[model samples]
Target chain A: MDRQLDQLLSSAGRPALCQSVLPALLGCIADIARTLRTSHTVALAGTANAFGDDQLNVDVAAEKLVRDALAKCPAVVAASSEEDPAERPVRHSRDAGQTAEEASSEQYTVAFDPLDGSSIIAPNWTVGTIVGIWDGASALRQPPAERQVAAVLGVYGPRTTAIVALRVPGAEAACLEVGIGDQDFRFHVIRSRVRFADPPFATRYFAPANLRAAAESPSYMRLITQYVGKKYTLRYSGGLVPDVVHALAKGHGVYVSPVTAASRAKLRRLYELCPIALVVECAGGRAIDPVDGEEILARPLEGCDDRAGLVCGTTDEVDEVKRELLGASLESCR
Target chain B: MDRQLDQLLSSAGRPALCQSVLPALLGCIADIARTLRTSHTVALAGTANAFGDDQLNVDVAAEKLVRDALAKCPAVVAASSEEDPAERPVRHSRDAGQTAEEASSEQYTVAFDPLDGSSIIAPNWTVGTIVGIWDGASALRQPPAERQVAAVLGVYGPRTTAIVALRVPGAEAACLEVGIGDQDFRFHVIRSRVRFADPPFATRYFAPANLRAAAESPSYMRLITQYVGKKYTLRYSGGLVPDVVHALAKGHGVYVSPVTAASRAKLRRLYELCPIALVVECAGGRAIDPVDGEEILARPLEGCDDRAGLVCGTTDEVDEVKRELLGASLESCR
Candidate 1:
């Protein structure tokens, strides 16, 4: 390796924060993805099944990866999951001047879906990762609605994009884009103005099933049909990577689900499967409970239990769907 | 890029087979897996109720990756799970020696579980690829089982391991082996000498529900206590990658579901997950069909839909389980 390149690689390999799970997961997954692309075998170690269930799912891998990344970091506390039966134990490496509480307290704890859209794997469908957060372990332990930390979802396809929510301080959100096919690539957050500058849906929709529902309403269906009839395409893949990429490229589509009864029905309420709902909302799009049209509560234990309803998209478009569904039938409300 | 490195990369990019739907699936899956590992956004195009009632699993971005890899191959027919209700078209690529007879005649085809264990993506479990052969398009045109020609399951884990089988001119039946994992991975054929290599007890017994019942059998219980006792360790991870890997490493285990009453009562019939069973048999283990104790057939389907029985390390172990189950119940066999 060139001296400069070696230095650069070493720097890249360095842990970014004391609570370094994110960087570690990012590095590990990147290596695995590249190896697989180059037609080589890739492996990951760290977390095993804490729940002791025989079934394999993304939660296991995601938790494992996150925990491994954070293994060296002492600041992160309670990197937890809806799927995990227990809170991850902080087996952090010993460091000087670190109290047990300070070592375990997460300045930032990331909850994630390490690999999403996994059911399609046997047939070779695209999969993705979703990561978001709440205040800390206390907030995470709270029911889903009570926690209020920002989040992000890194959806992978031919390229990978990150929808990041800046939680503290300014508390703004942005979309970070990375092209995997491009050899020398870097991430650039989609500008804030570009994220929320337009009316969410002035035309047809291109969305993943879950997000489409969370972000729109039944009345929007009329608009969607009109838009499609005018040559707009309503495209969606079961894989989150493809779905989010299409939405990102097209501009107006909701990258996540819309909050409306009809829309939620459309999504089949796969809450954790598409954490992009939080990502989309944080990035200036709408995130809501489709049936009630309420803002989505961050870190809500109740809403993300593999059974809660969620929706995301531009605010106005989401409202339209909710209005239409509410007007149509009370049954739709449930 | 270095010329040598570029050449190696290009060669790595080459499609493996000449005439099959596999090239596309392989490339797409490999790319998506790479993208996921690398944390890049991936997108798919052209998906809508194509292969079955559900959307075809392939899309535009995935197709491009597949095409680029297959550009140099000698493929006759290129089938994809993504294309709209159509068999893969035959190519006139010069390398394939396209001729009147060749173009019109039925050609070989491949069926693939391009991405396996994907459901675990959300949970981060081991995922893999499953490829199989079909004499023609018959298996694909109608049902799953009809298309198996030769089959292999490629699992993405700590190491890439390919559990493969071929029904070639081997004097008699199919031969199975672990072709992709371990630095010293070698194909070892099952011979009578090693056939009973292990103890008389089933080496690995999973399917806890069924095993518990088998353990309750008075005769089987006596045998386990007297012979197979403490050494028996029940191991099963819903993820096939680990389960198969563990079984391969450990030698023998029973993974039967007890489908039929007689088979269930006797605890003998575990032939359903053929590839797994084949690997065991090829590795000098015994896979029983419980009901008839016939040579287990790998069902030509998507999942482990067959009734279960016993998988043992040695013939003696299988016989012990069989004798207890069939003691006087042979006439009751289904």
Candidate 2:
């Protein structure tokens, strides 16, 4: 059941590493989710993810299934999981026959939130997995979110799906790459919208916020009231992945997490925000910090625990969040 | 296939008409939902329901399927649908061999809201079908909501489900059925929670409200703010069927529709509120009118076009809505 992560990746001199890992990652996630769906028991596992959030037994199993599968892959150099409690990242061994040259060139850093929102699985609400792939072991030297070269969201509900995005633009395009350094990563989505119908949704726009937390603050409360006043609908499922991907499939709406006095950021920057922001931004949508308007994917990964409120989705809604939550003027918000 | 509705009845005037229609109606709804789910086109049908609401093609097809099926049923002497724009209710013919004496005793009335909230199919959010069955073709004689004898909710999402309920108790009990008349209709749920996880969702309460509409008034704004302040989650899919069903499945949480000045009520009392309220109440949950503290199913279906603000879900959350929105005392609201 375990596949070496590195063997699935291509060397730097060869094709893109994302090409090999994409399908493998998607397969691993789907295989695990499908198996869990058939099991009648979906209760809490008395376990939690790295951030101490309670994990469902199904989620704990899905996390292990993915961690073990990726950890066995030779291409996966350093791996971090939302469910893994270990302080040091898990580093997989190179394949038996791999030469040092091949090992160094093909190695990848893989970070993932194995079962995002597994709690919803009980009532069979839509749930998903989110993964971020970075080039080489450097994913460890600096913050992992900043180093992510690819991110994918896999949703399993009424229909199964793998929404994939890759940074494939070559060195020639230096514009968006400056944020990611010399990697010259450009936004490119490989797949999207599994079983969801194509867009033409009259007024479906997602605004993911903590209602209780929002009400405590006047500014955040204003943003929420304004969204409702505009007659905008929401898709806040208490899970980050499903909310973001729902909007992604519809090609509209915004998913936001605003900072409140009690909680600086509820979503993990690397496991939650980075992958979603990358997918959204690549889909002709916008992903930015609610505070400074910096690209969400480019937010400096200050540390493993670094967190910043994020707003992601279509330009219109994100623009609204920027103006309302951050007080960015309409002129400068977009 | 259209089955004559009358032949299914006992004709002996056994208990009531609901007993005969419950099984047939559930079968009809389940059949139509399952068929629509497999169709390739999940897009909008470019048509709308009677309320001037947009209809998904799946919904349009589902509506036709239910109307046609019920029309052939002999037990269903009179039938009306949310999608049918006709002036007269469709009437099913009596069995070919039936005499006038038997026909008079066997006939029943059935009203349905087929394909409730089909628009969310674009994003594949949970959607459902609701049906309310009443005795006598005279269902047209009174507001169909007040005439309901039995009801069902069919949810089509990660799974297909059939939830049925009947008023088995005699009318002598004034505690729960004053709204349905001396018919002594009792509360009961046939089936429920096709895929939703069991209760104890920590804080997974779904408070479905019309945010924009709520904000138009001060009282509604206060209620919504209080919900947020109390840290309530939401599942407002702009569809009464799915939101109410979601809460029903979770076995906890609350779903509400408070009165607004501009709009009397958003959900149809006859087709939507009555059916869902029946299911939730039968499941050990509660459904009530935020204004008068009357049971939702007990609301006199004022007329065909009657709509009302509703609140339903687990006891605690609903009690909160009654107290905050309707100013009901702790003991009086319950």
Candidate 3:
């Protein structure tokens, strides 16, 4: 995967942060890739995370692999993950003895969910890795979505594949960074960079209406009913990354999970909402908060653990969500 | 992988029919499995199947492979699949010069869905291959559920794995024929028969209440609403094989799709229902038709193209289906 990015790697104009971050992340891909490749043997740890979701042996092991691999990179100064209760600082590889004042602003903060939807692992369902790249220490104080340098989601299923959405000024919307589809693909967990930055459009047209729609608020339920009445097919696995990525790949499809009566929402802002918002928005689509009536990425970060409802997909589909589901005026929301 | 099956191969009482069919089918596994192991390179053919569902390159290729590879099995006199309009005869490979009278009753019939839920492939959700083994050409006229000798479902996701439920004389009830968590595991696609037939059961419970519930019958809608009200987690992936297999693994859970107004049912009898029904029933679970209150497997064969509503899973879960969803009297249907 690093070969396709040789131009990016050698380019002079690219930001220094991603120049190191992307390649370093490219290196980190192997750890999780190994877990996915050997999925049949990974055991259930017989435990759950802080979120009360079950943890697989692969999930816990992969998270450590990513942290260890990324920590060694001089560019990764700090990292926050759903697996950890708080962010941990990584000592610069080149400046291990330097004080906090000596560390350069060129470093990055990585916020990620090492393994999303871990519950589905045993069933052999599609699960993924999600990461958000932030500029520096100060960038973490604000909603990382606004300053997100890049968003990467690796879906590990029948194939070990990764999608990176880069926000560099001249960068293309999305890149098939570490793909198995390339001619030089290796059988093991090594990187294979194919041609990068082709706008991935949906080959099949169907909105990824989340399965949780049935019990969503009355308005959301009505929206699903309308979609059903209109004959829009469904494409949802229980995983958020795969569901959203499916819509992004197809270039169209709505994925909604509004704040319901029982809870605020299942998706976390830093780990899920922001990173995915960056992905869809960059892919010629929209991601928004239905009730607040604003772009999801544009919203201020409530906290590290903040949650929000999501209605994300193609531009037209989000409009369908706003106008029909939220009962906002059609042309007004559009 | 084949070494684990040494016991089954050397057992003297093993049926003569499976001695050839199982090994041949085992060999055919590579053809379909190659699609998964090399998933990144398999292009999505811009085509749709006869069912109007979009086709993946792997789906079309796998179907032809299973057909071609299984054709040489002397025990397989004929094969039918969801991909084909009708049953296709398989000439005996070793006795090509012999007349039809020379072929003994040893010949068996096979009905299969070479690829199920092909649309979910691009998004990288779990899809599967389903096979049902029958006695002979004359037995094909009988309800497949009643006479099914062996039922096999191969799930291709993070791992290429299969589950087999055998009704052969002296064969165990439910066997983990091919498993990933075993010792002496290899990296290839080979059978690693686990503990044989011990009446597999559901562990983590969740019904695959598909999104079409809103458009389904009022009673079905209410059933979903009640399940949601009670906070029953969902396990459906819009794939029948994965959903059903999840229930079978956990020991109990229901997967039902009654005839909606706009369609008859999603599962076709010959390809999907009969095969899966035989598997679940053989596993000590129940597969029933809620409307008339009969075993789903006991229903007579309508035709090669016939379809039906499904209420399949564990006995109690299926009972909840009959009592709540179908409004059937308690114990009367059982």
Docking class of 3: acceptable
Q: For candidate 2, write residues B1-334 as lDDT tens digits.
A: 1122222222223333433355445556556644543342332222112223434455677777776667556566666667763225555544423334435555566667887765555444556788777766645445433455567676554434445554433431111110000011222222212222344556567655666666576667787777677777765555566566556555567777777777567677767777777667656677888768788765456466667888887876677777777663445657
Which of candidates 1 and 2 is the stronger one according to TM-score?
2
RMSD of 3: 6.3
Q: After superposition, which runs of candidate 3 have C-alpha atoms over 4 Å from their true positions?
A: A2-20, A23-27, A41-56, A91-105, A169-178, A181-216, A300-303, A323-334, B1-12, B15-20, B39-56, B68-72, B91-106, B169-172, B180-216, B324-334
**Candidate order (TM-score):** 3, 2, 1
Tell me each candidate's TM-score.
0.44, 0.72, 0.80
How well is each residue in A1-334 modelled by candidate 2, as lDDT tens digits?
A: 1133222233223342544455456567556645543433232121112223334556677777777667555666677777763334555534423435435566677778888775554444566788877776644445433466677776554334456655543421000110000011222222222222234657657665666668667777887777677667666676676677667545567877777778566677777788777677656677888767777766456555556788888776677677777674445656
Docking quality band of candidate 1, CAPRI definitions: incorrect
Better of 2 and 3 by TM-score: 3
Alpha-carbon shift of residue B222 in model 3 (angstroms): 2.8
Better of 2 and 3 by DockQ: 3
Residue A174 miss distance in model 3 (angstroms): 4.0
Better of 1 and 3 by DockQ: 3
DockQ, candidate 3, vs. native dimer: 0.34
**Against the true structure, what is model 2's DockQ?**
0.19
RMSD of each: 16.4, 9.8, 6.3
Ranking by lDDT: 3, 2, 1
TM-score of chain A of 3: 0.80
Candidates 1 and 2: which is better by DockQ?
2
